[model samples]
Target: MRGLMGRTAICILIILFAATAVAAAQTGDDAVTEGNITEIYSTIDTCDITLTSSSTIEDLVIDVQLVHEDRIIDRETLNVDRINANSRTIKVIRWNVKTSEDGAYKVLVQLLNNEEEIASKEYGFVHGRQVIPEVVIEGTIANSEGVTAVIRPVKATLVDIDYMLVDGTDVIYLAKDEKISIHTTPLTVHKRWNTLLLNNREYTGLVKVRPSDEVNAIVVTDSFSSMDDAKITDVYKDEIGASATIEGGSQVPFDGYVRFTVYDHDGENVVESVIMRSPILLTGDDETVEAIWENRLREGKYRLVIEIIGNDGDVLDIQETMIDVEKSVTISNDITEVVEENNSSPSFLITQAVLVLAAVGFVLRRRNIR
Candidate 1:
């Protein structure tokens, strides 16, 4: 009876083993298995997932996805109609590692047939090498007449930008909804400064960029502030100098300089010119500056012109007046200079007589010596 009972127990154990084996086979024990992930480097990273299956799958569509630190990077799909049974296959995938943060990654390979998943597997791998993107931003640049800015990328970003202008200096500012309106004449660089505005704050800089209208327009309009509203009330002439009044009007503050130009007779000759500025002024404020000719005036004619310049060095208003200096001096082009002598004065005759006497004495002395 003991021997019979032992045989029955052995048969029951074999039956359980067979049932477990059958269940394993039906649940894709013969299906695709997770394989190794190899990273090949050449400009970018190409990951190949090695998979093998013991059962054939028809109309196969294989997908290999790359994920870095639980974040999906990219996916590659292939149409491999029929995969033979007991075959090892490699699915290729490409991804940019430099664009992603440095961390551990996992590559998942999945096989599909008849729109149904046949087998799915995942293999985790750490990506150490960084593959930078070939191009971050690429575009074309064009400009209209008179420095109209042309920028394609509005949301693009740049770091450590240095810029300057003809009147102002280097400036840096955040490019956010920043409308760059450039209206300028052909002006040259005058001075340079080291102040900049980054993310709405000002800082000092050492790097220098071209002060072209395109760049400086943005910096000057945003980083710096200027309000130009002035009136030049026809320049007037004084005894030996010319003066003009630049009155800030229009209820706007003026924050620039005043330029004065005094011409000689015709408007072509620039006799005296000067630039004066009070820096800051409010509405209805006025400042007067004079450009004086230190020497006594020669008299004939003169013209005085005064101009109000904006912070960008643009001429706001120009007022010119012609003044006739009525004096005793007369000049001619042929004769360099001519001074009218007093005919009734006795000093002229006395000078002529003395000159004649000196000439006669010299002649007499030469003859006596001979």
Candidate 2:
């Protein structure tokens, strides 16, 4: 009998709990009221409150008040005529403080229907009369040395600039904590970046400037490509050596070398080869590198291959051409024949001996006569 009584009591409690939840849910769905402050944009001079209403409201008014030291400092009122039923109406109320004082303050935003308060929100702010700077990027130029971003700041501020691909995929470079004191003209910020480290294909440059007082950074983007290149422009060959003219593109600065390889007419046997150091190749500069062969080749037609190699030991370009050697070279057999002919000249030696004998005889005869 006791267990049956307890079971009956438990059933009654379960039914009562379920009925209470249903009543609460129904009350939430049928409630008619003005919505809360959805957004607030506060600056030193003004504060904007964005408010919304769910049900039909008429003769609505928005009150934005600034308070300090538990006292009302300033107030601004805006009137909204009406908001329809079964719909939503949102409005932004801009409140101008008209004060430049620096201190902590409270901002109260209220929505009213004919002097009756419907919804209210309070926000805290520390105003210093500092204007949030408007930053704009004019353009960006890229090269092997780095990327330069032209930016115009409307107000003076300290900012850091970062660069990356337009897709936000990777960071290319960063320049931090640059003070922009001039607001009248555009300034250039350069970040060291080697474009050769990236692909040769086209890419978009992205610059993000973050001011010291702002929470979010401003971004600008531009399209660009890697301008780093080294080309073998011209090649010249002489009797003793060969020289190549190398022109570097405007993006990156580097040092390079020239390698000259001389092969037989068949291009199978390397007859002579040499490697020579090149001058420092700067942006858009032309440098000439020369290589002298260690061994002289026989007079014949040969294949010449010239390679332009960078300081990093990477070959930048290769050029091949045929060279005809027409030098007047004296061989060992001709030298030996000339020596033999000079040694066998008996007539000349006989004339030299006769002249010496005549001189000796005349000297002896003069001595006897004396």
Which candidate gets the maximum TM-score versus the true structure? 2
Any runs in candidate 2 off by more than 4 Å, and if so which? 1-228, 327-370
Please report how far candidate 1 places residue 66 from its true position, in Å.
42
**Candidate 2's residue-wise lDDT over 1-99, tens digit each?**
999999999999999999999998876654434555666545444454555556666787878887877878778787767666554443333345555
Q: Can you give the TM-score per candidate against the true fold?
A: 0.28, 0.34
Candidate 1 vs. true structure, TM-score: 0.28
Error of 1 at 95 (Å): 42
Minimum summed lDDT over a 10-residue window in model 2 is located at 165-174
